[model samples]
Target chain A: MGGGITLEHFLVLGLILFLLGAYCVLTRRNAIGILLGIELMLNAANINYLAFAFFGGARYDGQIFAIFVIMLAAAEAVIGLAVILAIYQNLRTIDVDATETLSG
Target chain B: MLNSLAAQAIFYVIAALTVGFAALVAFSRNIVYSAFALVGALMGVAGVYILLAADFVAMVQVLLYVGGIVVLTIFAVMLTQGIGDLAVSNRAVGPGAGLAVVALAGAVMLYATLRTPWHLATAVAVASTTYGIGNAFLGVYVLPFEIASLVLLAALVGAVTISRQDTPPPADGAAEKGRS
Candidate 1:
């Protein structure tokens, strides 16, 4: 803990965040809750990308990919929320389990 | 030496903020609380980006992720009803199974991460990444940049099309019967 921050430290932090996100996604019944978990997972990945970029000769590629990921995440959030709204309109609930009409 | 120590302290604080709020987001019983807690988690990630010398990406993370997505999620939560029923509304299903799955995945990922012999580069002086990033986006990464814009446009149209109330909701029973 006294030593300066290292790549492993960032990697471990990301691992914890990713695992928490996985747990959130696996357990949450609410659709928005699942989306929130996905966001956390994506952030964890972004942290890894920036960490590698900083350490790997400080190239711009990692940051660029991170920007793209953020862009895609925004698109995903928009579409997902819209779908959730649509589901709520029809079923009056945003529970993932309750919207399992396609399971048949 | 003192400077590095201070940096380490700051890193620990930011790490705590990030992991702590993330835990809240994942485990909070109230859906609204989960949504709000996401702001803290995301902000802490931005702090992480800054620490990693990614100023532009950090700002973008703050702007897009914090300003855009979390607010949209909160809106979605408020728009839907039954939000007051905190106990059951944000219920967890199959906690034991979820824990088992996460633990297994965490173990594999942590093992790989720790065991890898990474090729490390000497630390370079921190510089503004905005100029280089802008050039790469316009020059080498132009195609992907254009494609991203197209994707955003498509998302805009699709969201409006899907969520608009003018269209009638699909007949659930009929759809299920048809599918079967």
Candidate 2:
């Protein structure tokens, strides 16, 4: 471990993670998988906040927003899961492809 | 040279893990595996935060994302299905276009970075991320915090109402015949 690190390292890592999350969002069929993708996307934003805070002048402001993002993610998970449960109750299957019942 | 060597090694390890786990989460077909991959990716992100001297935010990343959100996702996957879906893995989307777009975007960023002359003074970047975060929690961010709490409250109530299924009463009035 180094005594200290630099900004480039953090930025590169954030980029890679953000791309991965984006890929997941584009391809996942499971509603929960989509939610996980959203989680990654939000996390990528969090990384940006921390990086800006450390390297730029946006310190506390970034962390506070990141904290709110995390809280919002948790809330999203709860509501998403509830919605998923309701879908399961109606269709008996969790596949997103199968939820074409309301295509009209 | 030695100082940079250490930074380079730590950077590679954490960066590799973050990218690898994120790719896994994005590509893995089994929903549960994706959730688990999210845990790994989230931890790597926390590591990156720590590297940036944002120790408090890093801990929060571990606590809320890796610990809470990922675990919640796993429990949800378990609740909805049997063990069969665990084996049911398949690629659902074509990632080539997305990959191309990301690569192009990365190239643009790189070009922009190279085009600009960055400040190189040894600015003592002491990341007091926690102090700032604390101030926000008690200051301008209080309204958003309260609103988030309300959203959580609504989610809990909504979940309870949706999950609890009340039994329907006998439509033919079997209770009356039984009483007679």
Candidate number of the best DockQ: 1
| Per-model DockQ | 0.64, 0.50
How high is the TM-score of chain A in each model? Answer: 0.95, 0.88
Could you tell me how far off, in angstroms, the CA of residue B101 lies in candidate 2 after the best superposition?
5.2
lDDT of every model, 2 decimals: 0.90, 0.72
The stretch of ten residues in a row with the least summed lDDT in candidate 1 chain A is: A1-10
Residue-level lDDT of model 1, residues B1-180, one tens digit each, is: 213877889999999999999999998988899999999999999999999999999999999999999999999999998765353333445887888989999999999999999777878888899999999999999999999999999999999999987644467756545332
Q: Which one is best on TM-score? A: 1
Candidate 1 Cα misplacement greater than 4 A, ranges: B1-3, B84-93, B167-180
- Which lDDT value does model 1 have at B146? 94
User: Which residue segments of model 2 deviate by more than 4 Å?
Assistant: A1-6, B1-4, B82-131, B166-180
TM-score of predicted structure 1: 0.91
User: A18-93 in candidate 1: lDDT tens per residue?
Assistant: 9999888888878888999999999999999999998878569999999999999999999999999999999998
Encode model 2's per-residue lDDT on A3-92: one tens digit a residue.
Answer: 555555565566666666766666656778778888888888788777766566556776777777888888788788878877877777
lDDT tens digits, residue span B24-71, model 2: 887775677777888888898888777766788788888988888888
